[model samples]
Target chain A: MAADRVTLSDVAREAGVSLATASRAINGSADRSVRPELVERVTAAAARLRYSPDATAQAMARGRTTTLGLLVHDIADPYFSAIAAAVVASAETAGLQVSLATTQNDPAREVQLVDLMRRQRARAVVIAGGRSAGSSTEDLAGQLAALRAQGVGVAAIGQPVPGVPSVAVDNLGGSASLARALLALGYRTFALLTGPRQRTTAQERCRGFSDALGAGGGVVIARSETPFTWEGGHAGMLRLIDDGSLHGVDAVVATNDVMALGALAAARERGLRVPEDVALTGFGGISTLRDVVPALTTVAVPMGELGERAVRLALTAEGDVVESVGCDVVVRASTPDLRRR
Target chain B: MAADRVTLSDVAREAGVSLATASRAINGSADRSVRPELVERVTAAAARLRYSPDATAQAMARGRTTTLGLLVHDIADPYFSAIAAAVVASAETAGLQVSLATTQNDPAREVQLVDLMRRQRARAVVIAGGRSAGSSTEDLAGQLAALRAQGVGVAAIGQPVPGVPSVAVDNLGGSASLARALLALGYRTFALLTGPRQRTTAQERCRGFSDALGAGGGVVIARSETPFTWEGGHAGMLRLIDDGSLHGVDAVVATNDVMALGALAAARERGLRVPEDVALTGFGGISTLRDVVPALTTVAVPMGELGERAVRLALTAEGDVVESVGCDVVVRASTPDLRRR
Candidate 1:
């Protein structure tokens, strides 16, 4: 049998105060004219009864819930999880709870989640995923606009959404720098492993790396467009190896760290020693991948800082504020100094 | 400028129907006797208005929110992230959104999160963390009891809370089996790297392995207790190595996968070869760690399934259900057969 939860009415009766006075004391009335002693008595009674004010009722009365909606492509991915962790921590510091929804990399699901957040009257919504261009993107933009119009705050990480504030990472510059570093290390011919062509992240990183390599007199011998996942990277690397595309390639560059890790596994399975047989590099220096053997060389994007900045942007009532965070290239065992050798 | 959101009254006005009829048609009346034509009219009007029902209002009317609360120790950790991903996916299938809270491994924070969930009127809660015995546990028990008294479903993973259902993995059995497998491989001397002593999951694992190893005439030369993190494992391993406790230890057993990965890094940094110089083993076969060089030997617990099952148990109306999930010992290259040598 369900037991009756303690109600504010019971607290009022116990405190010997009027219902209005009890409510004002507990929920903090705008007037704030209640006597100090009365407030203390009501609070003590409420504490004694262990009464918790219903958030649903409070949201209805206040027009917004103390909840932030966080949308991610996949929570299981270390990249997304890292961002989600930062968002949750920062939201807590602001006295907000986070409702997380995974879009499962589906654009339609992302749109649906934004609508759901609007329905929940969330104080803010933070999107942490790459943008894909299509009708789904249009639908997402429309839904986000509707949410914004309802006085809900919205911000994005990784990529910009129309009319929404965003914290953008320097993916292009980071990838370009990584390529220049590799070029200096004597990698003349490279093979590229990229995500689907529609993803702006993949497109930007690929273009930056290729352009920088070209400027430095290096060449791209092969390119593979695959899903932005570990399996995709493994399959892409295997395909390149089987097709003899890596025969003369001095290095392989993946669009992201997880993909680079998958490529490393593929290389090992194929009996190739890293940096000795061929050098490797990736974007996004995820912390979880730090201990992997032949530590991956990557562009260390501040993922946690990106999430924190996105939350701050969403909570702020500023218009279209775009904050750019920079990344640094970390050279590790995966990409040894070939020039010295 | 804030725009006025569409309400049920607007839908009723557009449909030229009574407010009661609109409510019954849109939100589903208990009798289900509303005329089909009336329902169709209301639905079409609502679609035209692009009206979405406010979840707060609905929750106030129904006395419960269509939300699930998921509590994790650390979302950035692969182990918790994998479980969280499954819980979110399963909750979504049940038409519930998940509000995630990280306790930061603090018992007091866990209690506070449960209280927050109670205030939010969550339909169910799935706790994915180890239990520690103390007054904080008592406080948590009281909070969970109050939540259940108010008709909220509750279930735990990894360890059981008093009178609550749980989806428990066979940590003891899994660890014992792993120890036996190592013993069979002629690993006679070992060192143990465990998490904090208060964590029930870590205690059970350590006990299981030690007991099994003792039965097999193998001795644990060194033991270290550290935080349940990768850094903890690395530190524990370094401490043991530096103290000369591992001078002749045949292998090191880390209580979890991340710790094992950390220990592997420590070993590599010390210029020791894996399996040749010292074999290593860990519990929990986290998928993200699959590509590590000298693939780690671990007890492959179905973390995702545990999460899914916990969600299922929480959602079910049945009383106090306990589900035990099994694990398998995956022998990888990290633990070679010393008997063969």
Candidate 2:
């Protein structure tokens, strides 16, 4: 069966050239020894034979595969999916294949995946999502350094990894802007739904929103920290509602759009009308969540752009740099102008 | 740097065993010539040295890579994302890495991806999505046949490919059932937003719903063909509404859930109240879409299970097989029981 595959020797025979010349021409060798006419003849013969160069052999020769590894927390989540999609599109333009791995939000699993990518000799790796605090970061930093040492490009999307180039979203600034926007909407008292303390993204967003609210002379009546997931938001909102935290609260702020959606669902279940009864706001304006009824007020982080930039930074950037992507505070029906009334 | 990587010889030297014995023990060679104590020593030595096997070398040696190639229409779409996430999870359990590629619903690109996967010597390839008609299908079939000839297993989700194992959803039956369920709700007239003519999934779904409606003495007053996407559905619905086609329609059926959500958005934009002025339904029970307000009435296709079964079939099946996955009609707030009213 292996013999059936068209090889450089076959192309060389068909093109009336030596095997070495065919290999040099087809592999685009840096040596300018192969004649143009011979290169053309070899190319035409390979095309005629429908020959595909073995990727494994190519990787062995190059010492790195044309594989861009993307590590995401969960592909099913719209946030990660959006990023993954962008990465795939960008990788395609660069003529690279994407090897996608899910960490399932497990730092150990993430470390293992990084090792796997390293072993595979992937040309580049883009890690999406926030980093949790602890030894996992140290372990990851070491692994990334090893990968970089091996000439494999590495980039991070969320929090900046010590010496790696990263595309960090302005989480704190975005959340603060969203908070000020909500304050302008005449929201004085609020309930907050935040994510776990270990995640830097959650912590930054929560602090930014709270600090901004305090500066605006607004108050956070209640707060609940849960997992960074829709279900977690739902449960946290339910706990707050059940504990009678919304009695005088003017609005509910969820740290992310998915969480805000879950909060909306919980509010609906409890017979609370959005904007009319209690206003709401969220962060990370995912486009897929656009059509949600009453429309969510959110900080529109350019999720896809983040992915594209990360891929670019990984494959092309020089030196350790932190590229910041800005966010816009999109005021929708979820948070209305109470002052106008 | 390549010299820095630990080799089998390093393990053999550390274990005080012959290179052949180390290779046979570490790679689990069929020949049981290596002694058990030597194997244990080699394994311990390899572990102690933190030696990660070179996947590229292993692939070349085995004539196949431990890669599961997954081709999806678009990963950003919740439907494909759901299936992709499942495929990744299932592949992980089998110790296979998923090489994801998006065809962007282009058959030429899909064929090219298949060729790319073949070049990579992927262990198995799972193509998820509907097939388009014409020369592209023949081209794809040829590519897939070539893949199988090289001992690479192949499986498909959605429409079955010739001489390949597939996990096919009951699209026709699901739509028929959905139509009947809607009829039971006392809806007499309907407007349909369908996909392009070339897609088998769209064609089957449209025919099933329309045929069932005709058989049940219900009428499809208007039908519009658009791209099988959210924007298409939105545009199709808006066109129908503007053209007065939906004036007397009791319900609107979009072939897929994303399309249905688009139609719902269009209806809302037109100031039409769901289950009052009109009702709406979508297919493919995407879990992410569960939070949409008014809740969607849909035929729940087990997307994750489809991916899991496809991986299993591609890797383990001995013969061409078609595994049918069932769909269930889920009644929700969008479609009300008009008879009660």
**Cα lDDT tens digits for candidate 1, A1-341:** 15466887999999999988887777664345689999999999998998888777667666788899999999999899999999999999998999999998899889888988888889999999898877887888788877888888889899887778889988889999998999888889999998889999999999989999899999998999889989999999999888889998999999999899889999988988888898898888887567787888999989899989988989885687788899999999888888788
- List TM-scores for all candidates, in order: 0.94, 0.93
Candidate 2 ranges with C-alpha deviation above 4 Å: A1-3, A6-51, B1-51
Q: Please provide, for model 2 over A1-341, each residue's C-alpha lDDT reduced to its tens digit, 9 standing for 90 to 100.
A: 34588877889999999887887777655334688888899989999998888877777665678899999999998889999999999998998999999999888988999999998889999999899888998899899888888778899997888888999999989998988988887889999898888899999998989999899999998999988888988999999889898899999989888888889899899988888888888888877567798889889989889999999999987688999999999999988899998
Which residue runs of candidate 1 sit more than 4 Å off their true CA positions? A1-3, A9-49, B1-3, B9-48
lDDT of each: 0.88, 0.88
What DockQ results for candidate 1? 0.69
| Docking outcome class, model 1 | medium
lDDT of 1 at A249: 91
